[model samples]
Structure formats: C-alpha cells, structure tokens
Target chain A: MKEIVVISGKGGTGKTSITASLAYLGGKDIVLADCDVDAADMHLLMQPDFGQAKDFYSGLIAEIRQDDCIQCGKCADICRFDAIPVIDGKYIVDPLSCEGCGYCPRVCPTDAIDMLDMNVGKWYVSTIKTGTTMVHAKLGIGADNSGKLVAHVKNEAKRIAEEEDKEIVLVDGSPGVGCPVVSSLSGAKFVVLVTEPTVSGLHDLKRVYELVDKFNIPAGCIINKADLNPQVSAEIESFLKQENIGHIASLPYDENFTAAMTQGKTIVEYDENNLNEILTQSWAKIKQIA
Target chain B: MKIAIASGKGGTGKTTLSTNLAAYLAEKQEVVLVDLDVEEPNSGLFIKAELLREEEKYKMIPQWNPDTCILCGNCQEVCNFHAVLKLGEQIMVFPELCHSCYACSELCPTNSLPMVPQKMGELKHFNSGTLSFIESRLEIGQEQAVPLIRQTNKYVEECFSEQVIKLFDSPPGTSCPVIEATKDADFIILVTEPTPFGLHDLTLAVETMRELKKNFGVVINRHGIGNDEVEKYCSAENIPLLARIPNDRQIAELYSRGELLYKKIPGVKEQLDLLIHHIEGLESAGER
Candidate 1:
C-alpha cells in the first residue's frame, strides 16, 4: 500500500482543504489519517461517524504519594524541570511541568514516588459519510507527547488499510518541523507539500523540504493561493525546479474556500466547477507519481 | 506588558497582526517584537530590523566514552527516546532524537557517558527604530524547538530589565512550541479567521490559554468572507473580540510581498490603535 501525507511547514496553507478534496475524488475506499492531533480538523470536513475511542498512553510521569511522606526534599532538589513544588511545607509534582524523565522515581529515598504511563489523548476509527475509513486522534490541551499520538494514528490507519486490503492512505499531517511532523513523515511512501505563494510560505517550504530530503522521501509541491503574488509564485516555481521537486499543481485564491468552510463542507462539495477540476487534476498527478 | 499572539492552526495572520501591532506600538512604547515561531520565523520579513547579533543555541546530548572497562547496556535502558543504542562493544547516539533529559548519562554504569552541547537553532537580534526584535530560527531538520524558544525568551528577559511592550509571535498549534512561547506572557492575543476550521482550532487555542490561566482576547482576520460563527462563539465564551481585519485582496497582496499593512490597509492603523488601547486598559485594570 502506498501512503501519501499532505504537509505544510506553515499552517493554514490549505492542507486540510486540499486533503479533503483529494479524499473525495479518490473514490470511497481509501483510508484517511489525520495526524494533526493538536488541531485535528479533517473530521470537521469528513463528518466521520466515530466508533469506540481508545485512550493512548505515552512516556511516563512521576507522581509523588503524599501520604507516605517525609518531606525529605530530595526529589525536589534533583528534579530538572522544577515540577516538584513546595507548598506550605508539602511537596507535590506539577504534571504540566514534568518531562517524565524517570529521575524522581529513582532518586526518591523514601520510595514515595510512583512513575506511571500517562493517558495523553484518545484515537478513533470511524467511517465518513462517503464510506471511507478515517483514523484520527485528539491530544489533550497542554499535553506533551503529540509525536507519539500522531504515530499511533498513522499506525492504526495502516493496520485498518491492511485488514481491508486497501492500497492508499491519504494523510493530513501537522504543521511545522517539530516532532509530530517528523512522526507523520517517518514511513510515508510519498509526501505532498501544500504551500502558499508568500515569503513565509517559500521560507517554510524550504525548511520542510530539507526535512523531507533528510528522510530521503520523494515529494511533490502544490502551491495553494498561487495568485496571491505572481512574483513569489514564480520564485517558488523556480525553487521547486532548482530542488528537483515536482510541481504538481497551483491553486488560485478563491473566496469559495472560506464559504465552503463556513458551511461545514469541502470545496468540491460546495463549488464543483472551478476548484474541483484543479483538485482532481492534482490528485491524478499525485496518484500517477506515487 | 508581555503579549503573545498565537493560533492553533498556521497561516492565520499571527505574523501580520504581530508585526503591525509592534510597529504601531513602537511609535510611543519600547516594543520588543519576538518571533518565537522558530520553525518559520517570518515576522522579520514584514518588519525591517537591522541585524545586531546572532547566536547559536545548543542542547545537551550524550557522548559515550566506551573505554570504561565494562560494556554494560545501562545507557540504552534509561534512554526514553531510544537515542542511545548498544551494539555489542560499541554504542551509537542519535543527537537529533535526544530530548536532553540527562537520563542516559545519569544512569551510565561506568561513568562513560558525558553530556555534550549540540547546536540546535540560531537566535537573532535586530533593531528597528524603537522596536527591538528577537527571533529564533530552528536549524532545518531539527525536532526540538521548545528549548530554543525558551532560550530566546530567557535572552529577552535578561537583556531588557525595564518594562517594555513585548509581543511574541508564537508558532501555530497548542503543542510544546506554543506553550513555551505563551507560558510566561502577561496576556495573549489569539488570532483566528472567521471560518469553521478557524473557530474549531481557536477553541483549542483558547483551551490552552485557559489551562495556562493566561488572560487572552481574540482577533478575527479575513472577517468578511466567513460567517459570524466565530463572533458568536466569542460572545458566548465571553472572549473579547479585540479587532477584525477585513478580507481585502490588496492587503493579502501587500502581505504576500512582505509589506507592513498598518498604514497601507484602509482602516488597519485605526483598528490596531484601538486594539493597543484595549490591551493597555486591561493591563492597568489587572494592576488595580
């Protein structure tokens, strides 16, 4: 099975919208994976009927048992993140500040610290209105370990695709060159980088392109909002040529994107004429290349 | 007061609002605009800042000294990220994957592991009139951004002792980088569009600020194209709508060319003026 992940280093470059359109045009059997767990919005467009939710755990967090207490203050002294707070002569661990390095558990002389795996978020396997399987997740607010959660979502999507004998997995990856983006790009067969025609767009595209190069993965570019600035668009096209990256498509800025979004529908589902043809063409090119 | 502008999703005008707001506030106040979106620090493009200095930020990664007699696998066992690998008599360390937690070094049996500094990003300082700007740029292909962001914040706190108008352009998302940028701010400006995806991610950003217990307001961009669902949600949640910048093609054109939109946009300067006043009013009220 070939897995294709749509990513952009800069956000709001129409990654989700383009992924939704491709899913719609790719028939009704492709497995969808939305690895942007921090802001998973593909479900908004897909309207997935979610099944049972499973809690996902990642890394370990130290919890101080206050009852077995002698406030020796050893854990507080050795803690790197200063997560152990001293309040009114009592010591406690702030879960937000803890990095789960497994230090306090080993340093506690009184054996008051118990390190346990944390329940960071949840994942779901659902079917969209178009009868496509979608694997998505939600990471808790202020929660760490988003990279692991994204890996979980992708793995589940791959498993379901194998079981159902599917061939392609269309993934909507998170923004930036952080851990979550790394996990999303880890094992994907092909990457579709969707960006805009702006200075930030070109700048961040280079950064993500470098990351894709590091992974030694083949990638293509789709310049969203291509008409915003003709000069920058031309510059982006040149850069793609210099880097030997394929230019799959260029989509002009349209008010229909926001209109369809406000109406809780995909652009193809709303205005099927102008935008649909461009999107279907891009999808065809992607399929041919992948 | 320190103000951080953030959004849960990218390309939502965080840099546009931050640069324009800093330029507007720099007229009367000593504004330090920090582009903390290290992965893609684009505020420098909109605001012209004379280069002052640049420094490379480093994090600790383990270096194994394998000549301590015993070839125990303790370093590999304690590494949470699997950065340390034991291959019979040799060890391999992936510095990029290391979290700099010091777990492997602390647990090394024969004291053969040493924590060494590895450069991860660059911190830049620039001077633009009265606006002193700082921006962090993570090296391409690096995974750790929170440390560098925190380092930039620390540099700001140390370099400036007196009170100044600090505006942080945070990375898009409610993850580690966003938390690092917004955690210490006195107030946060949550930028969003009027579309459904905007509102959906705005809710997550709001939840993050609420969890941090930081005061914040929302600024709606591309106002005319999308519906009033964002405004309705803001009013329902009692989140003050600071300002709304209309969806103007001219403004988008100028922004795409890296032009500051304060004076160019028809009513943007006035809107930013009012937004600054509202923030100062909130700041004083908090003091009271």
Candidate 2:
C-alpha cells in the first residue's frame, strides 16, 4: 500500500481538515492513521467507532509500598524531580509528578517502594464515516511515550491496509518536528505539508521540511488559508521552489471549514458540490506519488 | 514572587513576554527569567544577556554488577517503561530510555544495581543588565524533558532567592514540563491567540492550572483576530483576562529579528510594571 502523511509546521493549519477530506474521497480504499496523539482532533471529523483499545505503557511510574514506608524522605531528597512529595508529615508519590523513574522505590530504606505497571494511554482501531479504518490513541495526562503511541497507530494502519488490500493509506501527523513526527514519517511514502501564510507558519514549514528532507522523503506543500496574507503566500512559494518542495495549491481563507467542523462534517461533505473539486485535485496529486 | 509566562500553543509569545516581562520588572527588582522551553529555547535571542555559567544536567542510570547477580529479571518485570531487559542471565539497561527511576537498584535480588549519572541536557545562565536568565537545552533525540525541567527549576530555586520577581518561559501545552515549571509560581500568565485551536488548547491549559490549584490570569495575544471563544471560556470559568495584547506585526517582525516587545514599545513596560504590582498586591492580600 502507498501511504501519504498530512502534516503542518504548526497547529490550526487545516492539516486534519484536508486529511479528512482526502480520506472521504478515498473511502473504503484507505486506512487512516492519526499520529497527533498529544492533541488529536481528527476524530471530531472522522467520528471513528472506537473499539477494543489496549493500554500502551511507555514511561516509568514509581510505586512505593506503604507498609515498609519509613518517613526518611530519601526518595524525595534524591528525586531531582521532587516527584516524591512530602505532605502532612507523610510521604506520597504523585504520579503526575513522578517521572516513573523507579529511583524512589529503589532508595526506600524500608523497601516499601516498588514499581508497578501503569496504563500510560490507550489506542483504538475504529471505523470512520469514510468507510476507512482509523487508528488513533489518547495519551494520558503526563504520559511520556507519545512516540510509541504514534508507532502503534501507524503499525495498525499498515496492518489494516494489508488485510484489506487497500491501495492507499492516509495518515494525519501532528504539528512539531519531534519524536512523534519522526515516528509518523518512518517508512512513509510521501509527506504533504499543510501550512498557513504567516511568519510562524513559514518557520514551522522550514522545520518540518527539514525533517522530511532528512529522511529523503518525496514531499509537497499545500498552503491553507492562503489568502490571509498574499505576500507571505508568495514568499512561501519561493521558499518551496528553493527547497524543491512542490507547492500544491493555496486554499483560500474560507469560513466553510470552521462551519463544517462545527457541524461535525468534513469540508468535502459539508460543501461537496463546490469545495470537493479542490480537495479531489489535491488527492489526485497525492495519488501521483502513490 | 516567581511567575512563569506560559501558553498552550507555541509562538504565542511565551519567549517574547518572558524576555520583555523580565526586563520590565528587572529595573525595580532583582529578576531572573529561566527559559524552560528547552526544545526550542529562544528567550536569549531577544535579550542581550551576558553569559555567566553553563552546566550539563544528567539522569542516573543503574550500573549492574553482573558478577554478584543472577538474572532474576525482577528489574525487567517491574519496569513499566521497558527501559530494562533481562535475557539469559544478561541484564541490560538502556540509558536513553531510562527515566532515572532507580527501580532496578531497589528491586535487585542480589543488590547489583548502582546509580551512575548520565548526561541528558545542559543549563545556561546569562544576565541582561539587571535581569538574569537561565535556559535548559535537552539533547536532540532525547525523549526525557521532565527530568531536565525539574533539574532546571531546582537549580533556579537553589541559585537564587528573593528576586522581587522571577519569570519562567515555559514550553507550550499543559503537559509534564509545563506543569513542572508553573507549579510553585505565585501567578501564571497564560498567553494565547483567539483561534479555535488556540481556544481549544487554552481550555486544556486552564484545566491543568485549576487542577493544580494555581491562581492564574490570561493574556490574550493576537487580540481581535480569531473570535471570542477564549474570552467566553475565561469569563465563564471565572479566570481573569489580565491583558489583551493586540494583533500587531511590529511585534512579530521584531520577534523575527530577535527583539523583545517592551524594547520596541516603551509604554508596554510601564503597563507590565502595573501588572507586577497587581500581582504583588494579590500575594499580600492572599497572605491576609
């Protein structure tokens, strides 16, 4: 299967909106994966029928047995994190504060502390309105293994693609060039960077592009809300040319996108008779690389 | 009082506000601004701070005494993060994956684990006239940021005391690092845009602050651009909107060229001076 990832240098760049539209057009033929675990919102549009989520453990959380507890404060003292907090003359472990480093339980003089398995987060395989399978997940508050979660989603999407023999896989990537993004791009066919027409957008575009180029992934750029700043849009076009990243099309500033989101619909379905044409064209370009 | 300038989104002026707010308060007080956005620390770029000190921060990795031990696998079994593994009488520790949780040493059957320090990031100190700043830089590809942030904060706590005001440029979002930075602050200044995504993330940030029970106020950056979603949310939630920084390119342009907003706009400092006084008043009133 050929996979295409939709990413933006920054949030609110319409990356998820565009990716949902593509999934709609590819209905049943594409397995969708969302790599934006930190603040995933694609589900609001996709409406995946989440099923059978399993725990994904990544970070360490310290466990202290209370019976052996000596109030020596050794763990709290050594905890560079102050994760082991002392309150009301009693020592307690704050999971949110705890980095799960096993240090506190190890240094406990009473041997009362022991590390226990924790449910860091959950991942789901679901069906969206597009008749495509969606692989998504939610990272628990203070959970540290987002990269692993991204990998889980991608692996599930690939598995479904092979099982269904789908010709295309669409993945929605998050806003930063961090570990999660790196996991999303590993072994991806091509990347479509959705960006806005602003200085921050351009800077983010450069950062994400560097990541795409580092992996030698063939890529293209799609500017969302391009009419917001014509000058910046032109600057983006030139930057893409210099970097040889294809400038796909600049989507105009449209209230239809927000309206569609509020109505719990993808832009294509929300304005199928008109806006679908541009979305379809974008899909065609993505197919070329596929 | 130490206050942290934070936001739910990146480029929402965390660095800009932190640097300028640092300078704004530096004139009257011994202020230190610690930029804890280690991923992309940019506070120093705007301030003409003179370098004072730099130190690398590290996490402890357990060194194994294989000769004194049998591969009990207890370390692997107790490890929730998979940072430890035992195979065929061989126990291996992955330092990069380790959160320095010392569990292996604590649970070792033969007591074969010893904590050995491993470098993870660096902390830099600088002074911009009266304002001193500290920044933490996590090594690229290093996944652990909470430890470094906690280390950075601890360093600041130990190194300085009674700065009339202290500011922390926190990382975006309401996650571990963000929580670690703003926990002990006297006030939290949340800078946010007014877009849908902006409002959405801002809600999450506010929820975190409320959950942590910290007193906070809002600073609406890029004001008058998106909508009133943030205003509505803040008003309904009883959160205060401390200030509304208008949408201005002069600020963005100066930011791109590495300049603080207070430096570009003189009166902005005066306004922040009043804001600082307000915070001081609140602290005193709170004590009452």
Candidate 3:
C-alpha cells in the first residue's frame, strides 16, 4: 500500500483539520493512522470506536520499594536525571524525569530499586465512522518515548492496510522536527506539509522541509491560510518553486475550520461550498501525485 | 520571576505572548527570553536584536574503541536507549538515540566505550537593549530535544540572575521537551485558543503541569472564535484565567509580519499590562 503522511512543522496550522477532511474524502479505501502521539487529536474528528486496544510498553522506569530499610542516597547520587528526589525523608522516583538508564538499580546497596517495563501509553485499532480502520494512540501524561509509540501506530496501520489489500495509508503526523515526526516518516511514500502564510509558518516550513529532504521523500505543500499575509504567501510560493515541492493548494483563511472543529465535524462535512471544492481538489491533486 | 509560556497545541500565541511580553517588560528592567521550542523556534523571528554570542552545544555519547581486545558486550547490554550495538566483531554508536546517561561508558570494563561530546545544536544569544534573547535549535534529524533544552537552561542559569524576569517560550505538547522547559520555572502560563482541539490539548497540558506540581495559569487567545468552554473549564478547575487576547485581524496581521503587536496595537498592550499586573500580584502573594 502507498503511504502518504501529512505533517506541519509548526503547530496549529490546521494539520489535523486538513488530514481529517482528506480521510473523509478517501472514504473506505484508506487506512488512517494518527502518528501525533504527543497530542493525538484526529480521533476527535474521526470518531473511532474504541473496540480494540493494547497497552504500549516502552523503556523502563525505576520503582523503589519503600519497605527495604535503607536510604543510602546512592541511587539519587548516581542519577543523571533528577528523577530521584528525597521527598519527606524518603527517596521517591519521579517517573516523568527518569530516563531508565538501569544504573541506579545496580548501585543501590539495599536492592530497593527495580527496573520495570513502563506502560507509557495505549494504542487503539478501531473502525471510524467512515467505515475505515484507524490506528491511533494516546501517550501518557508527561511521558517520554513518543517516537516509539508513533512507530507502533504507523506499523499497525501499514500492516492492516496490507492485510486488507487497501491501496493507501493516510497518516496524520505530529508537529516539530523531533523524534515523533521522524518516526512517522519512515517508509512513507509521500509527504504533505501543511503550513500558513505567517513568519513563523515560513520559518518552520523550511526546517521541516529540510528534514523531509534528508529522508529523500517527495513532498507537496498546502498553505492553509494563504490570504492571511499576501506578501508572505508570495514568498512561500517562490520558496516552494525553488525547493521543487509541489504547491498543491492555497486554502483561504476561513472561520469554518474552527466552526466545524467546535461542532465535531470536518470542513468537508460542514461546508459544501468553497472549502469543500478546494479540499476536494487538493485531495485529487495529492492522489494524482502521491 | 521566571515564567514560561507554553501550550499543549501549537500556534496558540505562545511565541506571540512571549516575545511581546519580554519586549514590554524589558522597557523597565532587564528581561531574558529563552525560546525552549528548539525544534521549531519562532520567537527569534520577532525579536530584532544584535548578535551577542553564539556557541555550538554538544551531548556526550559513547565512542567505541577497537583496540581493546575483550569484545565484551557489556556496553550494549546496559544501554537502555539502544544507541550502542555490538555486531559480530565491530561496535557501532548511534548518537541520535543516545540519552547521555553514562551507563554504557561507566560500565564498560575495558574503558573501550568512552564518553565523548558530539555536536547536537547551537545556541545564539541576542541582545536588544535590556532584553537578552536566547534561541537554541537542534540540528535537523536529531531525534531528541531534551538534551539541547537542558543545555540551554544551564546556559541561562549561568548568565542570568534570579532577580531578572525570565520568560521561556516552551515547545508544544506535553512531552519530555515541554517538561524540561517548564520544570524549573517559577510560574507557567498555558496559552490556548477556544476550540475543541484547544480544550483537549489544554486539558492534557493541565494534567502534565499538575503532575509536575507547577504553579500555572491559563491565557485564552482568539477569545471570541469558539464557545466559552475553556473559560468554564478553567473556572471549574480553579485555574487562574490570566488574560484574553481577542480575535483581532489586526493582531494577526501584525504577527504575520513578524512585528511585536503590543507596540502597535492598543488592545494587545492592554492585555500585556493586565498580565503583568496579575504576575505582580502573584509575586506579592508569594506565588513566585
């Protein structure tokens, strides 16, 4: 199956909204994957039924047994992360700060520390309202290893697509050029970079495009709020031409995006006029190229 | 006071508020603005400053030495990040996966796996009068942001004093980078819009801040766009609603042009003043 991942280097550039609209347009032929495990929100619009779930265990966390009568401060001394702190005269492990290096347990004289597999998040394989399977996940609050969870979600989506003989896998990637975004791009056939016509938008687009270029993946661009700044829009068009990235569409700034989001609907489902036409055409262009 | 402006969702005016707030506060006193959003830092776009200093940052990773003949797999066995691997007769180190925990190097019996610094990113210090703007960006394809963020925080602590007001433009999402950016702040301002996506991510950010036991408040941007659920949720949860930046096209236009809005727009200046007043009240109340 051919995979097409949508990403935005900067946040809140309507990446999820556009991805959801594309999924709706794809209907049952596409298997969807929400790889934005840090802030997975496509499920908010996809309305996936939580029928299949699995615990996602990644890395290890140090747990101290309090009954062992020893507070030698050895574990706290050796930790690079300030995960272990003396709280109320007892050494406590802050899971959020722990890197799980497995050194503290070895240095503990009392053997009070144990490295245990951490259940960092949960992944779900469910059918959405559009009669297509979606592979999504929710990372634990303040948890690390989001890249692993994203990889798991993408692999599951690709596996299901191949098994069901689906033609495409549509992935909604995360913001930023970090681990999660990198993990989501592995083995992807094409990339759709959604951005805006703001200074930050143009700045971040170059950074994320550099990453996509490093992976040697063909990419397309869509300026979501192209009319927000005409000058910046012109600059972005020139950058797209110079970089050889396909300029698929330039969507006008519209309140229907937020209006549809507040009503738990995609713009395609909410508006049947200009936005619908633009998004439909955008999807067609993506299909033609990707 | 060190205050961090963060949002669980991106493009929620974290950079907008941070840059303008720093500019406003710098008018009277020395202020430090650190953009901890290393992955895609945009605060530097709005700040017009003279380049003061720049330095490349590095993180320690294991470098395998083939001269040691033991061929023991202890380095690979103890590493938690899978950055080191012992394949047949050779050992490889992947710096991107390394967390710099010193587990592999310290545990190596033959000292074959020695820790060495590898360039990860660069930090640049810019000065515009009383405002010191620091921006650190991770090299592209670098898998982790926490190490660079930690280094940037160290640089700030070494250069700036505690008496000056410090504002951190934290990265979006409730993950390691976000936690590292806000963990040491005196207070945090969670910026959010008024939509479903905003509320969902804001709730996640709130849970994260509470987990870290941070003193924080909320600011609503694009105030008139969607329903009042964000305000309602903050009230129900007793989260102090600090300020509301209205949905003004003028502000958007100014921000799109990479201009500080508070200087040009009266409404933005009013919100910044109210936010400063609230912060001063927090300081007097010892919330700082």
Candidate that scores best on lDDT: 3
User: For each of the candidates, what fraction of the native contacts does it recover?
Assistant: 0.77, 0.08, 0.85
Clashes of 1: 1
lDDT of 3: 0.93
Give, for candidate 1 chain B, the lowest lDDT window spanning 10 residues: B66-75
At residue A46, give the lDDT of candidate 1.
87
| Residue A143 in model 2: lDDT | 57
- How much is A204 displaced in model 2, in angstroms? 5.7
What would the TM-score be for candidate 1 when compared with the true structure? Answer: 0.97
For candidate 2, write residues B1-288 as lDDT tens digits.
778887765556677678777777787768888988765566776777788999988888888888897877888876656778887878888876777766677678788888888887899999867788898876655665677888898898898876446788887765566777788888898988776656766776777788788888988776767578889998998888877776665655555555567756755665566667778788688678
In model 1 chain A, the worst 10-residue window by lDDT is A99-108
Best by DockQ: 3
After TM-score superposition, what is the CA distance of residue A14 in candidate 3 from its true location, in Å? 0.8
Q: Residue B133: error of model 3 in Å?
A: 0.9
Q: Which residue runs does candidate 3 get wrong by more than 4 Å?
A: none
Chain B TM-score for candidate 3? 0.98
Per-prediction DockQ, in order? Answer: 0.77, 0.20, 0.83
Docking quality category of candidate 1 according to DockQ thresholds: medium
